[model samples]
Target: MEKILVVDDDLGIQKQLKWSFAGYEVIFAEDRASAIAQLRRFEPKVVTLDLGLPPDPANATEGMATLEEILELAPQTKVIVVTGNNDKKNALRAINLGAYDFYQKPIDSDTIQILVSRAMNLFNLEMENRHLAAVAPSMDKIIGQSESILAASRKAERIAQTDISTLLLGESGTGKEVFARSIHEHSLRKDKAFVAINCASIPENLLESELFGYEKGAFTGANKTTPGKIETAQNGTLFLDEIGDMPIGLQAKMLRFLQERVIERVGGRSEIPVDIRVICATHRDIPGMVAEQTFREDLYYRIGEISILIPPLRERNNDVVLLARTFLAQYNEEFKTKIKGFSEGAIKAMSQHKWPGNIRELQNKLKSAVIMAEGTHIQAEDLNLTFNNDALSIDTLNLREVREHAESRAIRNAYQIAERNMSRTAELLGVTRPTLYSLIDKYHMDDIKTG
Candidate 1:
């Protein structure tokens, strides 16, 4: 039989629950310490914790601490918090702290048993889903189980065997180059070189020569015949990062090369035939640029024959914690530190944070946290995130109302975090001061003192 750990100070309640849970082997603990001990020993799938424990039976301080410790040690365990009548506030707090669910006291054995049964079913379902996701084919470098990322990975896998020109679109730091390299590695040209160049980083005057090569004495500094990225990637793949930033003048030449599979070196008349696959990536709006006449429409169509949009980290649910744990292990080994895991506050703060910079931002934060963290577990403070227990309440089903609620909550949280400083709050929310003020007025939040 599966095990259930019951933590309560009252013998009557424990005895009643013991009788209530008939099919499961139940373990009892009257205090926080013994409860954790039982938890480590049995590794129960579910735990029912009372918010009133010994040495602080009247208050929930010890109970809250117990909840945090339990989650810290066994984050996958489904913890159901039991609270007194009129103690819904503490129950909600427990939920925010990662508890599975809560129950109010004057316990009905039948009702509590029903709740426990549901929790067990949900836990089993989650474990099965995790097992399935783990078994799914995944990219070696891409670490994510979210559908958005997995879909993108599947698309990449399907296209990896082909030599078609591909385009990857995503926000900066979303690892477009990583996908490009993965495709190259999976292709028939795996043994060949994979050359990468950033169009935006190279100067306009030098980019043409860099992509198409320069002949001997092509320019003042052209001392010898040197192959450019295109030639260097012969029989392999060329990753042109920030392709949207390629100048319109250069786009025509790139278009010619793509159409004919040949190129002319700088100051050289002979057209050089090249055999290479091209993968382009950018965070800019290429179609918009084409419309504005800053980029050629033909070049746009050529490079974007097959395009994939990679989702930002914010859109990936639960992947934040998963990726954080993976990075924590890596950083721990690299830094030679034994940092165990994230604190409950850190986990909550990470889930709530809007990761504007995507995976790169998370990686940077974890690296620093690993090196600088004081305790065994990394806290929200270590990651520079606020440990705000009050979460946004989603009480409505309307889409517009949900967006409005999110906007208002984000504005309020940023404003408070910024100490009512208008500029700082606007910066935090990634909006202008005028827009911030307009939102505050629209939300009837003029009561917020702005400095």
Candidate 2:
């Protein structure tokens, strides 16, 4: 049976509701304190909040405070604010502050019951939608809701419909492979294999043979004819990561395979036809490499028929917090921890981070923090950021970049100057303790002396 919490000052009205809504196990509260107490204890999915309570039954002061506290603690619970007689002003304010709905009335039993039923139905529907979204595949794995990421996602889908050779460009750990797999999932070749190889991870001598299979006795250790990634990925998609690292000599061979959908086993002349689509990704500056006569311009254009540049974490506003929350939820489930969300200071702190390692870095921080967070909310101290100086060298001239670097350096210096005294550090900088605390997040000075 569904439970309902009824909060009102008058005993006559409360008693009337208890009998009127006999279908539900209704609980009663005469003041804001008892109402909130019942709310936390019961975890009721539905609440009939009154805008008139004992402390300030005249005005909606106490009632409004109760409403705010209820929503803050349990945002998922539907709060239907019961407004005063002809008090439309406070009623509208309640709705704006995330109340499920506002009901103004002399409290007709049937009408209020119907309203409560409507809120419950909506709650059930939303819960279903959330469950479906969590299990959905592909780009669903890409967590940010920022417009920048959504735009890139839409573009990736458009490219997926066709078999054009695509190139994913982004800094390391921005989820290049995740986007690649999303393309494969929605593409015509969804059932077949999606093979991937990193050019940087494998030795140059073995990379050529790794992509193009060798015949038995072709090499000293070749005991049997083993197919390479391209052949292994026949009728599927072959993802060549770090494509810029392929030797200049081998680039011509790769171009030949792309230009004609065929390959020759290393020591054999049999023209093996392969019906496979090729996708490549590289963080290295291929165009610059082409100008320097290192990377072949011809091969560059072939693999980049459709190019998608993944926006870095810092460039995607609001995405940092979005990704952080997503990672927090994921870690909570994986670690069997019940950490709720980020602190206000933590959100601001995460927002300003440069995230040199991008999504991978953010994910790592949260995974460790969820395990370490002692409180219900993961605070700035829990994230323990470590600034990577290598990312700062990219654009030292930009004022924002320079300022961010300077601030981090100053904070580190200030903490040391004050002999690890956080209060003294704030006083020395002539800012309040709270302001200094937020600055610690802005700079991600996690390891700095904060005693």
Candidate 3:
């Protein structure tokens, strides 16, 4: 049930509209103060507002004030104005003030309904798109040129052309979500909504309603009928982040929706058709989860039609310097600093560090360095990546050998610090469990095993 606030002084018009819009939850406000109070309380997505109010019934002043107030309170709300036929100038002004649309009053139910329905649909669509974009990875802010990142970019471009579900698999802070949005922008459905939801962020009980939506009275707090993320993403892309955290029960429903391209509201009987392309990302071993029966096999197959593995920053040669320079320029402008670039020693330290937290960690370090560095050049000390005299003397000869030694040492340290907890060890090392398992395989470290 979409909630609509009808603000008009005419009692007869209000009564007729209230009864007619049986499909909606209608709230009425007869005066400016009452209407504003209702607006603050209800926060309706679509409002039918009369430009003539009690204090200034013959003029548009009071109505315009209400319109401005509504906009300030909820910038996203769609307020449709109702004005007299002769008040064309005022109606135009209302539109400029951000009214969704206007209806010249001699109130006809059919016409009003048409206008209201359109406004409601558009409002829902916009809201859904915003949600999608929020969840999907956006690449607009990411700056990089490493071979690994470039390869991932190429893959993302190709994946965007098809409507196939893509799974971005990587460790945390590797910019998996950024690739997801690049896919959206490059895809054919670029104009449509790009909806994103994080399985890990939302609570289990509310997750289903957030994804599948609910009809009025579907749940304790559900006061109106609403389209879920899936419905909103119709003809668009839906990005699900940290998908490994989705509950087992909801996984089944999501799998069903993926298979059938339809969903039923949590408490609704009707199946709503949806036309959405799904993209999922996680720092978990989904295949392992499927084998363990923690995640449904069917959903795994559906979401991973194509899987793209994002290489960690440490693995992407030369990308560290490239990204650091980019971030340096960005934060310099952001922080209003005169820092030119990194010192040669700072660059060396950045290249040599393991980058356990990957790109995100590097970004934070650079941001801090830019803010704290007093001189034009950022030094290794400013970046907090100190080079111990003994560690620095280790021969730079045999680069691959050096990397293997670093990887082994980091794994061993992480395991010992985590008390042999594989999950905690993997997290400390800034690698996904699967990646950690691979390391365990490579290094033959069975002694460090922990469930």
Candidate 4:
């Protein structure tokens, strides 16, 4: 049976609660010390804490202290503070200090039982969710179950054991570097250094020296001979992030290095051989850049020998929730806060938001929410996502408009789920090919491409 700890100094209230909670192994404690001892011994999931103890039965100091201590010991424990009928102030204070819920004196047997039952239910639900999250589907170091992510991961896995140049294509903040590291970690050179450099972050003037190193007195600031990123990863992998941002001048040098597996440092004469695998990532359309003459086609083809496209968070279906839960658990442990989970509205908002910034945005919002959230559960407001109102406004009550909106949404979703295959989309939507095309034209969704 589940244990319920009732901390009350009054004999009458203690006897009343014991009889009131006959279905459980009820434990009683008269003071803070006894209450903590009973809490440690029983480890009850639910506890009814009275604000009046022997040390200061008339005030709330001892009771408040006990509540803090209980939560500090076990943040998961649901402690319902019991205050006098007029002590709602202290009750609210206890809640801010992390008490699960609060109750008032002269408690009705039915009301108190309902409160305890609700807390127990929430506790069990959170525990189950935690266990489920622990075993959530993952690919190597990646956390996702969407077909888009899985497809990308499978491609990465297949080419990891090879030395082929890889290009990771994704939107900004879509964890491109993570894919790069995962590939290197799974490669033959896992034990060797995995160097990463952002082409966009480095200046055009210094980029060449950064990538190819420099000899002593190569420039005014070149104090000594130093190895470039490519040379440093002699037997390992070099991740050139935002490779599309690399200058046209540098592209030729980079191409030569890739072709010869050798480099000549700035102001140096001898060609230095460096056997390193190259992995490049960019959020830009390198093909478009090549067509526009802004990027070198030869370099693009060289680095993109094997390309993997990582889908944005918005298109990953329910993977957003999985990622959010993972981040919540991580931040919870990092901050030493026991946030049970996200509120229903928060989850709904997260699912609805487009997540334009992808995993990085979600991570930032979740970290801030974890630290700033006042309640046990993170709310929609904490994440800065608007909680959608279920109530239909007068403007949205028109049947024809609502039908059109729903149909458009359904068609788009079906088209995506069917991987943009017209016949498959029609079959999924239970519509003829002509009808699907008509709907797509009606919605003006011709630009929707499979990313």
For model 4 the local lDDT of residue 360 reads 95
| Residue-by-residue lDDT tens digits, candidate 2, 1-451 | 7788999978888998898778788998888889889988887878998898886688888888999999999898898888754676787678667787666656666557656876777677667757856654346666666788888887887888689999999899998998888898888998999999998898889998999999999989999998999999999999999898889999999999999989988877798999998889999888999999999999999999989999999899778986787788788889888775775446656876889999999998899999998755676778885333324555358664466556656666777899889888888887666556545533434455333
Q: Whose lDDT is greatest here?
A: 1
How would you encode candidate 1's per-residue C-alpha lDDT over 113-158 as one tens digit per residue? 7668867987886798678667753366777779998899899988
RMSD of each: 11.7, 13.2, 27.6, 15.1
Clash count list over all predictions: 0, 0, 6, 0
Model 1 bad stretches (over 4 Å) = 1-138, 392-451
How are the candidates ranked when ordered by lDDT, highest leading? Answer: 1, 4, 3, 2
**Candidate 4 structure quality by residue, lDDT tens digits, 217-267:** 989988999999998998999999999999998899999999998899999
Give TM per candidate. 0.62, 0.62, 0.55, 0.61
Weakest lDDT window of 10 consecutive positions for candidate 4:
442-451
Error of 3 at 400 (Å): 22
Better of 1 and 2 by lDDT: 1
TM-score of candidate 3 against the unseen true structure: 0.55
For residue 52, what is the lDDT in candidate 3?
A: 94
Model 3 alpha-carbon drift over 4 Å, by segment = 1-145, 388-451
